[model samples]
Target: MTRSDDESRRVYATQGLIDLLLERAAAADPARENVVLDATPAGEFDADLGVDPATPVLTHFYLPAGRAVSDVFGVDLGTPAGRGRARFLTHPQGPAELTRRDDLAGVVLLAVPPWGTETLTAFDRQGRRLPLTVLDAEPPVESLPE
Candidate 1:
């Protein structure tokens, strides 16, 4: 197969695995149901990119309840509840800034650490804490040189 075709297969497999894991985790905790799962520090990267690694840009995927947040809001991306809370500013441009994919099954929120610091906590609409099974933020080991 061509390299592109092989890569496509790998991507699909990886997504399948992520979906399966999320399903199981959500099943165990009703609070986690239909919520975004945040992976921050575990997802930090070098500052070589345009963004500051210390002010990590964390993202989570969730099905939108009624479009976007009305205004800037604070949220916990960490587990055990209150340990992590950060404020997020809604982009004036809206979701289109993130993805042009009309076929997307859910919305993706891009959140940056507060004051160049990291925190982890997640909450449902009712402001109740939700459990999260964070995935590694780094690239796959296979992508690295031996």
Candidate 2:
């Protein structure tokens, strides 16, 4: 696929992600539902936990300005609801990794923080805070000692 095709394909993929998250949220039992968040954009990040590539990655974006606002979203990745929020922190993207914005920094936990809304906005400039999630975080590169 060309660059345009790739970009277009992502549009569809992102849409699908929204659908799944709504389902998960509705059926979410606070006792069981859990989401993940990276403290910082530091290094590489992860979008999908362990599901297939088709599984949509979740995201939250503020409208108008398209800046990131803390919100929670999720998917029962690679497991059943009984597992209860299996999202574990990977890299230190939160405060521990922040070179700036420490006031907004936090631990890179799998659970998304509560935003007092049902949806997580991934970039709805129109102003709909649907729990938009994404799994497009890049993984850390491994380097060997020289």
Candidate 3:
């Protein structure tokens, strides 16, 4: 198989893993109600090409915001319940600009609970918390694509 074909397979496998995770999360929590699985992008890159021809992909999965505030931190944010309480505050910088900037290529899985509005968390492809913030609770917007 060609290099491009291998890369495509890898990307597909990665997406499958992410899909499985979301499915498990939904099954684990029936109340999870809204589960969104954004699609990852497929592409080609050249090493000889100047500037790493990478890209940033944002896959946002919005759930309801929870209603409990915990002084406890550093918990496993990958859990369905845990991520429900987490929010993406900011990136390596402050919590100002978290939008796609360059071809860095990253995946964000956001879980906003339905009950509360002050929760937000962004997880990486490996389900690790990057940064999060808690704001005034707001109802989850039902804008996710089916």
What total of clashing residue pairs does each candidate reach?
Answer: 7, 24, 18
Model 3 residue 98 distance off true place after TM-score fit, in angstroms: 21
lDDT tens readout by residue for model 1, 48-144: 3332244222333333333234233343222334322322222222331223321211222222222111222333333333333333343223345
The worst-scoring run of ten residues by lDDT in candidate 3 lies at 42-51
Clashing pairs in 1: 76-121, 76-122, 77-120, 77-121, 78-120, 78-121, 84-120
The global C-alpha lDDT for each of the candidates, from Candidate 1 onward, is: 0.30, 0.30, 0.33
lDDT tens digits, residue span 69-130, model 2: 22222432333334221122111222212222221212111223241223232222222222
Q: Which is better, 1 or 3, measured by lDDT?
A: 3
Error of 2 at 7 (Å): 15
lDDT of 3 by residue, 1-146 (tens): 67564333221112333344445444544333323333322223212222123422223343423323222444323335523321222232223223453111243434333212233345554454453222122222335688
TM-score of each: 0.22, 0.22, 0.22
C-alpha-based local distance difference test score of model 2:
0.30
